[model samples]
Target: MTTSAALTVRVVTSLEEFKGLACEWERLLRTVPGHSFFVTWEWLYYWAKHYLRGNQLKILFVFDDRKRLIGIAPFYLRMTSVYGLISVRELRLLGSETVCSSYLDFIVNEQHKPAVLRGLYEYLFGEARKTWDVLTLSELAAESSTLDLWNELFDEAGKVGEVVGTSCCPVIRLPGDVDTYHAGLGRNRRYTLQRKTKCLQRAGRMEYARITSPREIDAAFESLVSLHQRRWGTRANGGVFADDVSRRFHREVVQVLSERGRVSLDLLTLDGRPIAAIYGFVYGETYYFYLPGFDPTAVPKASPGLLLLHHRIEQAIREGMTTVDLLQGAQPYKLEWSTGRQSLVTVRYYNRHARAVALKLGEGVKQAIKILVR
Candidate 1:
């Protein structure tokens, strides 16, 4: 534990303690500016429930003199080996790795950002310095205030850190009306959407439905999984839902968020049979387009995937969403629809320990080799 002025910092390590924090956790999150769905309690908690088998929780909490929660660093520790030899302990953000969670950060009330960040820095690097060898914070939005503040702190402390560009998240800034949004699209895209919708309608009776009832979640989720697997079957890597654990994690997320009316699971059907599905979340004023699956064999010429996406965007516009986020990819389809892109980066900090020094040197050598090969 550590204290600075009117702030106190501490850690929560057990699952029960984490569970008890749901109310306070959400209260604090609401105060954060431009926070994403990935940082919500339901998302991170379910992720931890399914993915915490080999890792240890190190969630940090900050409070004011009045005992009000002010900040959260949802972190976990993992043991990683270098070259199958030396062991290194890494502190990582909880909703990372295989989940593809974007816009991750330390959830802090904007008013207490500096003080809370100072307390966190002191606690992590001062009192708890010996516990971790490296800190790896990934999937941070390039413009996130948390990213800027941490960069300042690391620079002041003279810590050995590197900020590396990781991925691009394409986004569409929506206008007030659906017709205006349609007008802004490129000519070719507008043509494709119109042609595809007409062709699909000509084929059969078409319907679009958003799954909201708890009873409908399981069946719709299974359909999503089947379509996702079928779409990726010919590719080298299998779909994300191929594993049972991942499926369970997402299922729990959708089930919990659905109660709050935040989950958006839409299916497009033809003649009473499902042809395409889009799974996403509605958080704040943005609609996150997280995943999509469509039958490649069913009316391939009609492009069911594209048509479903068009419908979702139209729905978002009508529902007062200001943005449509195609999270964590620069795929051609995403860029074609995007009006802008948010850059994501990974920040790595290595303490001056023997293991950390060796790892840093190894990383430098790898970079050198890559440059030479290029």
Candidate 2:
């Protein structure tokens, strides 16, 4: 714990204590600017519940003098082996790389970001420094305020930190109407979309369904998994929903968020047979295009996956959504439809301990070897 005249910081280590902070967490998240579905209580809590077995939670809470919650650093400690030899304790954000979570940061009130961050820094580096060898913060948005603030803090303290580009999230800003959006696309792209739609429609009766009911989520979600696997199973990197744990995690998240009208599980069916499916969410004014699957055997030339995405975009525009977030990928298909992109970065800080220094040296050697080989 750490305190100042206006701010106080406390760490929540137990699962029960973390569970009790749900309401407060949600409230604090809402006060954040551009808060997305990834940071919601449902997403992170369920993620922790499913993936927290081998790790220790180190969630930090910052509060005002009146005991009101002002910020939350959803962190966890994990023991990682360097080259399967040296064991190093890593202090990482809760929703790290495993589940492809993006826009991760400390949930802080805009007004008190500086003070809250200072409080968190004081506790992590001042009081709890020895608990971890390296601090790994990943998937932060390009323009995230935490980036600059933390960099400043590190510079002021003469601590070396590395920031590297991790991935890109392409986004499509929607207009008020679908026609207006179509008009903005390039001629060749627009022609391709039209031709695909017409080709698919000529084959059979096409229908788009958005599944949100809790009772219907299980079936819809499973359909998404099946199509997803069929599409990606033969590739070098298989489907994300291939494992039982990933399936269960997403199913629960979709089901819970469905009750709150936050889930959008869409399927494009031809003659009542599902061909393409998209598992996404509707948060704020944005439609998050999280995952998609399409039957390669079903109208392959017509491109069911692309057609399904077009239908979702049309629906989003009609329903007044401002953006369609193709989360955490720079695939050709995603870039074709994207009007803009959000850059994501990973920040790493190493302590001066021998273990951390060894780890840093190991990383440098690996980079040097890669460069020489190239």
lDDT (C-alpha, whole model) for all candidates: 0.87, 0.86
Candidate 1 CA-lDDT value: 0.87
Q: Which lDDT tens digits does candidate 2 get at residues 150-213?
A: 8888778777688745889999989899789888987998899889888989999999998989
Worst 10 residues of 2 by lDDT: 365-374
**Model 1: how far is 230 from its true place, Å?**
0.5
For all predicted structures, in order, the TM-scores are: 0.95, 0.95
Model 1, residue 279: C-alpha shift (Å): 0.3
User: Candidate 1 regions off by >4 Å?
Assistant: 365-374
Give Cα distance to truth, residue 182, candidate 2, Å.
1.8
